[model samples]
Target chain A: MSITISNISKSYKNVKALQDISFEVKENELFGLIGPDGAGKTTLFRILTTLLIANEGTATVAGFDVISDYKMIRNSVGYMPGKFSLYQDLTVEENLNFFATIFGTTIEENYDLIKDIYVQIEPFKDRRAGKLSGGMKQKLALCCALIHKPKVLFLDEPTTGVDPVSRKEFWDMLKRLQQKGITILVSTPYMDEAALCDRIALIQAGKILEIDTPKAIVKHYSKPIYNVRANNMYQLINSLNDYEYNHSVYPFGEFVHYTDKRADFNQKELKMYLETKNLTDIEIEKTIATIEDTFMELAK
Target chain B: MKIILYIIQKEFKQIFRNKGMLPIIFVLPLLQLVILSNAATFEVKNIKFGYIDNDHTSTSRTLVEKFNASTYFDVLTDFPSEGLASSSMLNGEVDVVLEIPQYFERDLQKEKYNSLGITINAIDGAAAGVENVYVTQIVQNFNQNLKVDLLQVSDKQIQPITIETIPLFWYNETLNYKTFMVPGILVLLVTMITLFLSGMNIVREKEIGTLEQINVTPIKKSQFIIGKLFPFWVIGIGLLTIGLIIAKLIFDVPMVGSLVLMYFYTSIYILVILGIGLFISNFTDTQQQAMFIAWFFTVIFILMSGLFTPIESMPEWAQILTEFNPIKYFVEVMRMVMLKGSSFIDVLPQIIKTFLFAFIMNGLAVWSYKKTT
Candidate 1:
């Protein structure tokens, strides 16, 4: 195992941020923790990176204890914080060189690792880091973290505010980094990014809802889902709930995705029942479950 | 160590690139050294005086000539009466006035005793007192001269008593206020620049979200701090060097001490300032708050550092309070090295105090910096 966490718990003054959370990432696995804001993702990443100490239990990165062997863990792992955290006044080249020097290495020693990404922004290396575009800064921060060729990489919501195109490019770069035999643990709020990871943990309110591959998690969501749209969508949903057949009804964009509570509920009866309410343009079709669907089901 | 060099290089680049602040850090200190130095002197000149010559005789005229010949006073106007002379003194036009009574020479010849009226402005009491001494000395000299010329034709002898006082000023021969103020002002400039720059550096990173990125890195806390402070330390020394050069070229201030010794003390002094800047950086979260707090303490330090006023003249409590001020030691060492050409042994106490302050401040800064979980 590249990372091992057991019974880890942390809390603020009156709020528990993480409760008995335990998980492991295998060597060279692209693992992800998927959650919305305030789901304890940053807290957990901090503990795993040895920047924070766990109040209970133990975590080991690369076979070294996080607290007792923090130096070893730091030397072996790389972390990119959720926010852009690099020296702004320094030039891009200077920032990279400084971080490399701190880790007892040089740009020439690890040039092969970051060359693919650094080259794209190499022309503007002399520009101050503060003046660079967000995407360019993101790339520079990544290069600094990877300059030492660590065994595991921890990135906490690295693409939260990035543009969609930059977000896609960032994930593509992560894929290439994974090819270099480095274990990567990334966290994100976007459900779509869940499928790109080897395995993912769905978290809510500081608790894990599920931990499995995206496809497996979706397959395990045993429910009949339907996308229902009508001229009067609100009335349809409210009336459907009263019919005692609705499991859950939530608006998904312009249409409502509803699941049946009873395994034997008939769709034809539901359609007829909606028509009796004088609802026009009614369309009800069974749809495949997605990671978001599984997450909502598990959360509920 | 190599990381520290990288950090130092980065700091130099930032300071040089900041166009708005470059002149403020480099040029303002030199300008202050030149302008404020001229205004700080204790030597008094161009003292205006008015007189009412009631006797209007050659004796009174000779006394007036004596006053005019002296460098301390200038006869601004001759008042027709004592009322006019006293009114001019009240209106602040004249600092002193002389009233020669009627028959002053006749009484001096007959009774060998006469008193002339002398009134003086008492505000700024010290300067007024010094001027009074100068007036008395000139009058006594005139009395002796009169007795000598009278004795040439009479069968009598006149004996005059005189007191001679020799003043020996140590450390500064000419007592040029510029030589004293330049080193002290340089200390203030070094402290202000380093404290503000280093205090703002980390807070800027925090504001822009880059501090989080550094936290995630595998670097140790000590390494990060050393990297951050090393650069500002270099910049602090660079500012000192520029300030010294300007002080020499423009003000013609003598650097009597060894250049190597100045550099050595300056390096240690900048370390103290860098440590202070780092300590301030750890306490503040925003650049504005950091600047305000830095500015607040800087005002207090400059006022209490004995730069503008003598600490010995302050109240006993205030004098005791200055022992904790780091600027006090810096100013003391700079003055000792530059003006007195003091050897390392001569400034050992100040050096030790500053070194201790540097150690404690930097230690506190590192301890306060937390890698947030």
Candidate 2:
């Protein structure tokens, strides 16, 4: 395993940020800690990176214990903090050179690794980091983190504030970095980004809900899901929940994806129930569960 | 060490690239050194005076002429009444008013006794004291003249007393206030700029979510800190060099001490400031908060550092409190080196104190910077 975390628990004053959290990322794998805000994603990342000591449990990155071998661990990892952490006053080229130098390396030595991304905005190398557009800054920060040629890259919500196109571009860059045989641990609140990961840990409220491949996790969802639509969608939802056969009913997009308590119940019964409530033009069909659906089910 | 140099290079780039703060950090200190140094002299000149001569006698007239003849006092008005002269003094229109009493010459001739009323505005006590001394000296000279004229015997003798202060002002012989003020103000500028920049740099990263990216990386805390502080240190030194050059050319402030010694002390001083800034940055989550806290401490340091006031004159407890202030030592060392031509041996104590402070503060800063898991 490239990374190992066992029974890692942490608390902040009165709030429990993580509880008995354990996970592992294999070498060169793109692992993700998926959760909403305040789900202890950041806490776990900090511990693995040796920035924070776990309250209870042990975590090791690349065969070195986070506590005892922190210096060695730090030397090998590339961390892009959740925030834009580069010096804003320094120009793009200067920031990159600084990070490279800190790692006891030079831009020319690692130019092949970052040249692809760095070249895109190389024209503005002299421009102050603070003045760059949001997308450009994101690319520059990534370049700086990668310039050190770290073995393990830990990115905490690298796409939180970026535009859609830039977000896509950033993820693509991460994939290329992963291709270089670097262990990648990335966390994000965006569920859509979760599917891009090779394996994901669904976390909520500082607890790991589940950990599995995206397809496998969705495949394991056991509920009889249905996407229900009707002319009066609101009334149809109320009528469906009020129905005696209802298990769970929640709005998902333009239609409501629901499940029934009776596994063998058909759509005719649901339609009859909706019609009895004076709801018309109702349509109901079975649908495949998504990661969000799995998350909602697990959260419940 | 390599990481530290990288950080230093980055810091220099940032300081120079920042258009808004470049002028403030570099130019403003030099401008103040020039303007305020000229304005801050203790030598008094151009005193305005008014007089009420009730005696209307030759001796009183002659004394009035003597006052006019001296360049120190510009005799603006000759009032007929004491009421008018006193009102002018109360209104601050005149700094000093000489009131001559009735039959001043006759009394001097018969009884060898006379009195003169001298009213002075005493708001600025130091200047007022000096003016009083000058007035007393002139009166004594006038009395001697009277004695000389009345008792023409060559054998006549008079007692004389003189007080002299052989002021051996070490460091700055001429006592140019700029020589003192430039180095002191430079300390403030360096401290303020570095503290604010370093304090704000980390917080800004935290706000923008990039700190997390670095955190996940295998980079060590020491590496990160060295990377961050190195740049700010370079910028601080660069600003000091510019300030020194300006002080030399525009103000003619002497660089009496060894340049190498100055650089050595300044390097340690920058570390102390950068450490303080990083420590503050680690605690604050926002740039605004970091800036406010940095500004607060800097204001206190500059005010209590004895840049504008004598540390010796402050109450004993206040003077004791200043011992803990790092800026005080930096300012002291800079002035000692620049003005007094002090060698490294003379400034060894301050240098050692700064080195210890830099170590403690930087250690605390790195200790405090943790990944908030």
Candidate 3:
């Protein structure tokens, strides 16, 4: 295992950030922690990176104990915090060089590791980090984190504020880095990104709801979800929620995903109930379950 | 070693890249040195003078004329009655009021002794005291001349002997306020700028979230701290150099001692300031908090530094408090070295104390500074 966390718990004052959070990431694996905001993803990242001490339990990264061998762990991991943390005054090239030097390595020594990402923002090498667009800054931050070529990389919400195209490119680069034998533990609030990981842990309110491969997690939901749409999304949702057999009702993009309480659920009954209410053009069809559906089911 | 150098290089790059802060670091202190040294003075001048001549004699007119001739007094008004003079004083038109008694010079010749009534505005006690000394000197000079004129008329054969004490101001012969103040103000500029800059630098990293990123790196604490502080140390010395040049060329403040000794002392003195700055940064989470705390201590340090007031005259307890003040020692050392030409051994005790301060403050700062929490 490249990372091992056992019963790690952390609290800030009265709020529990993490409780009995135990998990593992195999070597060369790209693991994702998928959750919404304030879900203890950052706290877990900080603890594993040795920037914070857990209130209980223990963890290790890159085969070194987080507490007893924190120094060794620090030397072996690359952490990109959720916030943009590079020096804004320094040029992109300077920021990259600075991180490389502090890690006891040089850019030329690890050019092969960061070439794909660095080349994307190489034209803006002279521009200060503060002046770059959001996408470029994210790329530069990734380049800086990878310049030292550590054994594991921890990215906290790297795609939170990025555009769609850059977010896709960022994940593709992560795939390439994983092929180079680097273990990666990343967190994101966007559930769609979970499918790109080898495995994911679904978390909410400091508790892990489920952990498994994204496909397996979604398959384990074992409920037939129906996509229901009408002229009025609000009225459709309200009518479905008022149905007697309704188990769950969530708006997913253009359609309302609904699950029934009974094992032998009747779709005609739900459609008839929405028709009586004032909603028009109602359509109901069985839809495949997704990671988001599984997360919603487990969280509920 | 290499990592520390890289960190230092990065720090210098960031410091120089800040366009708004460059002038604050370099130009403002020199400007303050020139403006404050010339403006902040102790010698009180241009005191408004008003008097009532109840004596109505040539002797009283001569006394008033003496005050008019002196540069220290403006001799603004001549009141007909004591009440008018009192009202003028009340209205703040005059600072010193002299009332000659109704004796017309006859009492002086007959009794061989007389006293004049001198009223001074004591609102500013120190300035009032200086004004009083000036008034007495003029009156005493007039008395000396009067004795000569009277003795010639009455008895020319006998000569009276009087005791005289002539004070020779040793280091500052002319008592130029600028010469005395330039070094102290230079100390203030150096201490204030270095303390504020060093204190806010680390907290700026914290505010921007870069500190969290750096904390995860394998960089040692000493390497990070020394690298962060080294640039400000150089800037502090750079300020002292600029201030000294200004002191030499503009103010003509003498550099009586060796320049090497001043630099050596300042080099060590800056360490104490940087340590204090780092300590402040260690405790604060924001630049604003660090700045407020730095300003708080800088004000206290500047006031108690004996820069403006003499520490010897403070209450015993306050005097003891100043013993712990680092600026007090810097002020004393700068004044002693620049004005009095004091040698190394003369400032050895200060050197020892400052060295200890640097050690303790930096130790506490580094110890309190945590990379992991």
Candidate 4:
């Protein structure tokens, strides 16, 4: 394991941020910490990166204990905070040179690692970092984080507040870095990103509900699920929810993801029931489980 | 050590590139040194004088003439009654009220213990104090003239035990206010620039989210702080040089002391101020908070540093408080060295105190700063 977290907990005054959270990420694996905001994703990343200490338990990154060997861990890990943290006043090139120099390295020393990203931003090297567009800023932050050539990378909500194309391109960079044998511990709120991770830890309210591959997580759904669409999605949900055998119901895009409590559920009966309620053009069919469905199920 | 040098280089680059900081660091201090020195003074001039002559004798008129003859009092009006005199004072027509009693100079000639009723506006307490002293000196001169009139047939000297006092003010023969104030204001400008810049610069990084980026790196805490202070230290020295040149060129302030020794003392003093600033930056979460706290302490230090008033004149407790103030020591050193042509030995004690102050302050700063929470 490249990252080992065993029973780590943290709290602020009256609110518990993380509680007994345990997980591991393998070497060269793209491990995604999937959660909504305030689910302790950033907190766990902070503890593992040795920027914070856990109150209860121990964590090790790159075979070094987080608290005891924090210096070594800090030397080896590259952390991009949730916020865009490069010096806004410094130009793109100056910002890069400053970080590299402070880390006891030079741009020429780590030219191979940042070449691709730097080239894209090289045209605007003279421009201040604050004036860069969002996509450009994201790329620059990544380049600076990678310039140190760290053994492990901890990215907190790297893709949050990012455009779709840029998000995809950023993950692609992470994939390339992973190919170079660097362990990646990344957190994101988007459920779709879960499918891209080698293994995922589903988190909520400071607890890890489940830890498994995305396919396995979705496969763990015990009940047969359904996707139903109608002329009006709003009334369709209220009408289906009024059914006596309905176990759970929630809207997922154009379809209402649903399950039944009945031992022998009948789609024809559910359709007839919706028709009686005047949910016309109602369509109901069995569908495979998605990560969102699994997340909502476990979160319940 | 190499890492610290890099941090310093980066800090200098940022300070120069910041258009807002450049004028404030360079122009503002010099402007204040030139202009503010004129505004700050203790010499009371042009007092608005109103008096009630209840005794319309030669004694009261002669006394009024004495005041009018002196340039300090303007002698705005003569009132017929106490009510009118006090009313003019209430209307802000005058700062001082002199009321002669109805004795027609009989009390002084017979009893030789008559008291004049002198009322002064006490607002801006320091100005009021100086005004009171000037009025007392004028009254003493009047009494001396009376004595001299009596002794004309005998001798000019009022000889009980004649110990003639030859009052001479050294280093400031004329007691020019600017000669004293320019050196003190220079200290304030240097303290203001270094303290505010170091405090705000680090706190700005915190505000911009860059501090967290620096914190997560392998940089040592001391290295980061030393790097941050290096540029402002140079700026402080540069400010001192500019202020000194302005003082010499415009105000013709005497620089009898060695410039090299002054720079050496100021270099250490700037460290103390910057250390305090960085310590404040380390604990505060926002630049606004740091600015407020820095402002609070700087105001207190300036007030207690005897920048506008004498430290010896303050209460004993307040004087003790000034001992802990680094600005106090720097202000004293600047005045002592600049005006008195004080040699290195003259300022050695202040230099040692400032060095200890720098050591303690920077030690606290480095100890309080942490990379981890």
Candidate 5:
């Protein structure tokens, strides 16, 4: 395992940011910490990356203890923080050179490591980081982080606030890095990105609810799930929430992914119930579970 | 060391690239040095004088002429009545008012002694006290002149044992206030520039999110602190050099000692100031908070550093409080070396105190900073 976090807990005064979070990320694995905002994803990432100290338990990254061997971990890992943390006043080329040099290497020595990502921004080499668009800034930050050719990489919400197309391109870059034998640990609030990871952990409220491959995590959900929709979406939602045995009701895209606690639950009965509420054009169908369905099931 | 050099290189590049900050760092200190040096002075001049001379005797007239003759007093007017002189004093037209009673000259002739009623504006207590001294000195000179003019072999002529003493002001002859203030003000400018820059620089990085990147790196805390402070240290030294040049060319202020020694003291002193600033930076989250804290300490340090007031003249407790101020030692060293031509031994005590201060403060800076909390 490249990262082994055992019973890690942290609190900020009165708020318990992370509590007894335990997980392991294997070598060269693109592991994803999947959760919504404030779900302890960042707290875990910060602890494992050696930027924070966990109050209870231990974390080892690259076989180095987070506290005792922080220097070793710092040297072996690259972190692109949740925010764009590169010097905003520096030009693109200057920023890249500065980070590379500080890590005791030159840009020429690590040209190949950052080439694919740097080429897109090579044209704006003289542009100050602050002036770049959100996507461009993300690309530059990644290049700076990777310039050292780290053994493991930690990306904290790298795709937040990025355009979808640019977000796809960033994931592609991470995949290429993994092919180079670099273990990647990335966190994101977007559920669909979970499928891009080798294994995923569903996390919420300072605890991990499930950890498994995206496909397996979905299969791990034992409940029968349904997609319910109607011409009056809002009224339909209220009617279904008022259903006698509905387990969970959350909107997914144009439909609501729902489950019911009734063992003999019938979709025919649900549709009949919505019709009496003056809802028309109803669509109900059994759907295969995805990571989103699995996460909602476990989080609740 | 290489990592530190890279950090320093990056810092210099950022500093030079900031167009708005270049003039502020390079030109503003020298400007303040020249303009403020003229304004900050202890030498009291231009004391406005008005007196009521009811007797109108030669002695009283001589007293007024004596006041007019002294460069310290302007001798604005002679009021016929005490009421008129009091009115002038209330209007703020005169700083000192001398009231000679109707029998003033007769009293001196009969009683062999006379007292002059002198009222002074004490709003600026220091200036008022200094003006009183100047008036007493002129009156004493007139008393001697009276003895000679009277040609008295009387009982008063027994000749009180008088010791004639000549005061000689060395180093800064003519006692030009600028000569004394330029070096002190230069120290303040150097201090303010380095402190504000170092204090704000790290906090700004924290705000912009770059400090997190630096923190997660494998760089040592001491190395990072050194790298962060090196640029401002150079800037502080650069300011001192420029200020010294201006003091030489414009103000004709003397630098009788070794320039190399001054630079050496400043190099160590800059570390103390930069260390304090970085400590403030590490504690604060935003540049505004950092600035407020830096300004608070800067104002306190400057006021108590003996820049405007003499440390020796302050109350015993206040003087002891100044002992902890690095600026106080620096001001003393700058003047001792620049004006007095003091060699290494002459300034050894100040240098040692500053060295210890720099050591303690920078140690505190490094100890207080934490990459992982």
Candidate 6:
């Protein structure tokens, strides 16, 4: 295993940030911690990177105990926090060179590892990190984190504020990094990004609700879902919630993803009920459960 | 060692690149050195003088003429009565009032003793005290001359024995306040700049979240701290050099001690300040908080540093408190070496104390700094 966490719990004052969170990521696997804001994803990452100590339980990164062998873990792992944590006053090249030098290596030593990402921002090598755009800043942060070419990478919501196009490009970079045999433990609030991981843990309020392959996790939903659209998205959601047989109703991008309480739910019945409520242009069709539907169901 | 060097290089880069900070580090302190040494003075002058001649005799007129001849007193007005003198003092027209009593010359001739009434405004006690000294010296000179004149008329052969003491002021012979103050103010500039800058440096990283990134690295605590503080240490020395140059060129303050010794002492002294700064940065989270705390300590240290006030005049308890003040030792060392031409052995006690302070403060700073919490 590249990482192992068992019964890890942490609390700050009265609020418990993480509670009995336990999971593992195999070597070369791309693992994701899927949750909303304040879902203990950052707390978990801090614990694994040895930036914070868990109040209870134990975690090991790269076969080194996070507490006893923290030095080894620090030496072998790379971390990019959610916040942009580079020297803003330093130029892009300086920031990269600094991180590399402090890690007892040089950019030339691992040029092959970061060459693909570095080339993108090479034009702005002399520009200070603070002057870079949002996407460019994230790219530089990722490059700094990967300069050491470590065995594991901990990226905490690296795409939270990035544009969609740059976000896709960032994910592509991560895919290539994984191909180079680096185990990645990433967290994201975006559920669509969760499917790109080899395995994911659906987390909410400091607790892990489910952990499995994205395909398997969605299969675990065990309920039929319908993509129901109408002229009025608000009334369609309201009508679905008002129906007695409706198990759940959520607005998911131009449609209401709904589940019926009964195992044998009738689509025509749901449409007839919506029409009665004066909700026109109602279109209901059976759709496969996505990772988002699974997460929402598990979160509920 | 190489890591520390790299961190130092980065720090220098950031410091030079900051447009708003370069003047603060270099220009402001030098300006303060020039302005403060010239402005903060101890010698009081331009005392307004007034007198009432109750006896219209030559003796009283001669006494009044003595005060008029002195450079310190302005001799502004001659009041006709004690009431007028009191009113003039109350109106803030005069600082000193001398009332020669009635029959002043007759009493001195018949009884050989007479008292004169002298009043002084006591607001700004230090200046008033200086004014009183000037007044007494002038009156005593007049009395001495009167005694000589009377002795020659009364008995020519009898000569009274008198003791005269000629005091020589060493090092600062002219009692130049600027010469005394220049080196002390230089200490303030060096201490304040290094403390404020180093205090805010690490906390800035914390505020910007780079501290968390660095914490996850494998860098040792000692290496990071040494690297972080070394740049400010250099700035402190650089400031001392610039301040010394200003002290020599602008103020004409003496540098009697070896230049090498001053640099050697300042190099260690800056470590003590940098250590305190690092300790403060370890506890604070924001640059503003660090600056506030740094400013608080700086104000206290500057006042208690004996730069403006003599340490001997401070209360016993406050004097004891100043022993722990690092600026006190620095001010003392600067004056001793720069003015007194003291040797290494002369300043060894201060060197030992400052080195111990550096060791303890840096130790506490390193111990409190945690890579994980």
User: TM-score of chain B only, all predictions?
Assistant: 0.85, 0.85, 0.96, 0.88, 0.92, 0.94
Where is model 4 more than 4 Å wrong at Cα? B53-62, B99-117, B124-126, B139-164
Q: Of the native A-B interface contacts, what share survives in model 4? A: 0.83
Task: Report lDDT (Cα) of residue A140, candidate 4.
Answer: 92
TM-score of chain A of each: 0.94, 0.93, 0.98, 0.97, 0.97, 0.98
What's the CA error at residue B259 for candidate 3, in Å?
Answer: 1.4
User: Which has the greatest DockQ?
Assistant: 3
- Share of reference contacts found in each model: 0.70, 0.67, 0.91, 0.83, 0.83, 0.85
| lDDT (C-alpha) at residue B16 in model 2 | 74
Weakest 10 consecutive residues of candidate 6 chain A by summed lDDT: A233-242
Candidate 6 lDDT over residue span B1-373, tens digit each: 9999999999999999999999999999988888998889978788899988889999999998888888888988888888988988899998999888899999999987999988999988999889888888988888889988777554756666789999999999999999999999999999999999999999999999998898889998889888988999889988888888888888889889988888999999999999899889989999999999999999999999999999999999999999899999999999999999999999999999999998999888877876223
- For B1-373, candidate 3 gives per-residue lDDT tens digits of 9988898999999999999999999999989999999999989999999998998899989999999999999988889998888888999999999989898599998887999999999999999999999999999999999988777544765766789999999999999999999999999999999999999999999999998888888998889998999999999999999999989999999989989999999999999999999999989999999999999999998899899999888999999999999999999999999999999999999999999999999988888896323
- The residue-by-residue lDDT of candidate 2 on B175-237, one tens digit each, is 677778888877877788888888898887787665755565444677777777777777788
**What is the per-residue lDDT of model 2 for residues A193-289, given as tens digits with 9 covering 90 to 100?**
9999999999999899999999999998998799998888778778777877777888988899888888688888777878788877788898999
Candidate 2, which CAPRI tier? acceptable
**lDDT, candidate 2, residue A196?**
97
lDDT tens readout by residue for model 3, A1-300 = 999999999999999999899998999999999999999999999999988899999898999999999999889999999899999999999999999998899999999999988888999999999999998998898888888888999999999999999899899999999999999999999999999999999999999988899989988989899999999998888888888888999999999999998998877877788878988898999999999999888888
Q: What's the i-RMS of each model?
A: 2.6, 3.5, 0.9, 1.1, 1.3, 0.8
Tens digit of per-residue lDDT, candidate 1, span B86-188? 8888889999988889998788877778998989888988778888888899899998888876554444534546677889978777777788888888888
Off by over 4 Å in 2: A89-95, A106-140, A147-151, A162-180, A230-246, A262-281, B1-3, B78-91, B149-307, B321-373
The fnat score for candidate 5 comes to 0.83
Docking class of 5: medium
Per model, how many backbone clashes are there?
A: 3, 35, 0, 0, 0, 0
What does candidate 1's lDDT look like per residue over A1-300, in tens digits? 999989999988788999888888999999999998999999999899877787898999999999998878888888888778787778899899888887889999999999999998899999988899999989998998899999999998989889999999999999999999999999999999999999999987788888898899999888988898999978987877777768888778788888988888787898899998888888899988889888888888
Pairs with steric clashes in candidate 3: none
What is the C-alpha local distance difference test score of candidate 4?
0.89
Candidate 2 vs 5: which has more TM-score = 5
